[model samples]
Target: MARITYIEHNGTEHVVDVRPGLTVMEGARDNNIPGIDADCGGACACSTCHVYVDPAWVDRLPKKQAVEEDMLDFAYQPDPKRSRLTCQIKVTDAIDGLVVHIPEKQI
Candidate 1:
């Protein structure tokens, strides 16, 4: 399993173990991490799992899909360079220490 860390806007951090094929959103919601409602689960329909990937790790993940790209428009903390839908980020060794930050609120 890969270790994923989510740092909240106020600096609180949540750590969880994730399976290789699971999406980050799944790990968060399943593990009961805060701020990730994942109302649409991992279907890429809701922006509730929106997060900001550390700039250092941004290039290490794949590009978001059109569905994720579109849904991100609903997030309260959208940032073109950093905002991403966590459901679109699959677990991989390259992201074992992956740390994404959740904004204070979601739209």
Candidate 2:
């Protein structure tokens, strides 16, 4: 399992172990983390699971595809360099220590 950290806009932090092959959005949902709403589940069809990836781990994550990039355009206060959709990020041992900060709200 990969250990992932989800930080809320209010500074709350939830760290959980996520099984490989699942997306980051699943991790948050399973752990009952409040920030990511995942309105479209893991279909990459919405930006409700948007987050700001920790700068330190940005380069370590897999590159975003066109679909994910397009969805992020609808996220709240998206940061061009750090915004990402959790549904698009697959969990793996390589990203075991990944940290993502949830935006203040989802739109």
TM-score of each predicted structure versus truth: 0.94, 0.98
Shift of residue 48 alpha carbon in model 2, Å? 0.1
Query: Residue 51 in candidate 1 has what lDDT?
Result: 92
The residue ranges of model 2 lying beyond 4 angstroms of the native Cα positions read none
Best by TM-score: 2
lDDT of 1: 0.88
lDDT for every model?
Answer: 0.88, 0.94
Candidate 1 TM-score, true structure as reference: 0.94
The TM-score obtained by model 2 is: 0.98
lDDT of 2 by residue, 1-107 (tens): 99999999999999999999999999999999997999998898989999999999999998999999999888999899999999999999999999999999999
Clashing pairs in 1: none
